[model samples]
Target: MINMKRRTFLKGSVAAGAVGAAVSAGLLTPRVVLAAWPSAAFEAKSVDSALDALMGSHAVESSDKISIRAPDIAENGAVVPVSVTAPMSNIDTISIIAEKNAAPLTAAFKLGKGAEGYVSTRIKMGKTSNVIAVVKAGGKMYSASKEVKVTIGGCGG
Candidate 1:
């Protein structure tokens, strides 16, 4: 390995340390971090409230076209894998909701133009509840759900 001069090493370390300290102290935050987060929706206690806050209304049309892929029983509720597939064009947004969670609005994703109508991620669940997938497409809201039994609670159970 090429030896690094003491001066060079010290300079590199100082720069890294300075950047780290600035970030930790909230002094050098990038504007793009947590951009356009639906804070009110995420903080909503009830699923209906969350849906209303996030999607303007909870009234959705049940559709077989949307599919939610998840395990029937999640051994660890802390990191349950969930996948949503809405094989329809003009999809605008996809959201995942865990009905029993304190903050029932687990995750939401906005799809760009012509983007795939699919989203996959892990979400925490407090208990056994229905995992719902809501999709907004063509100025309409469609949804589907599947019950997920959590053997071990994830939200501080």
Candidate 2:
């Protein structure tokens, strides 16, 4: 038989009940938990506009320090694997952009101080286009791009 203490069980029950009430009352939403959502950046229609909205500037330097790993040809454009690796220091953010998508900015990730500059995720490709990786480090923006061919369109061909 397992030993269970009455006081311990009551404490856990109260904690759980408090959490459940907070959630049910919509007090524990994503916006409240996480950082502020960048709606303008995500809603931008063009790649340049998205970059401008996110990074506060559209001009980005092309750099060899950033590497993009993605398939040259995607069989299903719906879920194409993409990864970005930047072995540079002071990486603030990493953003993925699909050149031909209606809203070019696919994903953006914020990194903490002293964090490794690596982000991997699957993104939807509207058609055959360039997959661009923009890295923000030390208040400067650097970018790298690779062409990806999509066999089946994902975003409303």
Candidate 3:
């Protein structure tokens, strides 16, 4: 009787270990995965082209709802502080792009419900360029821009 109980306990432990391993390997996580590959706006040559690719041929209007804050003159082009804020509700995402930089797209933020649509980060500017904030709201695109002067050359400008 003792030998039988030991065998049964060992079998149960092995089964539990296998189930735990599977669950840890994403077998139990509920994930809604996207099928398509993510698009890259950074490699695009022009702002319009990057916007077109990002917005998918949709018309984007300039709006005051989105505000882009950056220094008019950046003493150091290597790292320029930039911030974007959207006053509107239901903001899906916020993307920051530098027009004249070699890689246009600097950073992107995906906003959640009840979360403020604001992002601040340092971006490298090759030269004086327009820093654009593209906000996605109500399945539409809106943008605003501010020109930032990069006095000290960064990115070999």
Candidate 4:
């Protein structure tokens, strides 16, 4: 006779519950299970090229309505904090572009219904570059950018 222990199915359920909590708290964006991921857009080398691939023929205008809050100087090129906030109606997506990175597009957020038009995340900077925040709302694209100087030590004294 052999005795087998019961599987920890509750543990898996707990993890799923945690993900639900994160979605409710807006900490993480839930992705469509079978949605196709955009590889070419994120793999584009230049900012303009990436934008063209993502937004097609649409014009991107610089707007004061979009605010990009990033450190004027980032001590580390490996991790730079970036945040974007816009008080606009019908926001569809927000994308963060690290202008000088090998792959310029760093993060793209697809805002769901009732989700606040704000996104904050840490991105890698290959060197000193302008971080641009692009927002799509009401069939128009608005953008803002800030230059962040990367330091050597990666930790300010």
Give the range where candidate 1 is weakest over 10 consecutive residues by summed lDDT: 26-35
Runs of candidate 1 with Cα error greater than 4 angstroms are 1-35, 153-157
Show where candidate 3 strays beyond 4 Å. Answer: 1-39, 153-157
Cα lDDT for residue 153, candidate 1:
39
- Tens-place lDDT per residue, model 3, 1-55, is 9999788667755644453344346443312211232233444455654554445
RMSD to the hidden true structure, all candidates = 14.7, 16.0, 18.3, 14.4
lDDT of 1 by residue, 1-157 (tens): 3456666556645644554444446553323323568665676666666666666567799999889999998889888999999987898789999987767889888898768999999999888999999998888989999999898634533
Q: Between which residue pairs do clashes occur in model 4?
A: none
lDDT by residue for model 2 over 1-157, one digit each (tens)?
1346666556645654554454446554523332777665565666775676566666799998799999998989899999999987998889999988867889889898667999999999988999999998888889999999998734433
State the weakest 10-residue window (summed lDDT) of model 2. 25-34
Pitting candidate 1 against candidate 4, the one with the higher lDDT is 1
- The segments of candidate 4 whose C-alpha lies over 4 angstroms from its true place after superposition are 1-35, 155-157
Error in Å for residue 48 of model 4 = 1.5
Error of 4 at 22 (Å): 37
What's model 4's lDDT at 51?
Answer: 60
lDDT of 4 by residue, 76-130 (tens): 8888899999999899889999987767889888888998899999999988899
Per-candidate TM-scores read: 0.73, 0.74, 0.69, 0.74
Error of 4 at 117 (Å): 0.9
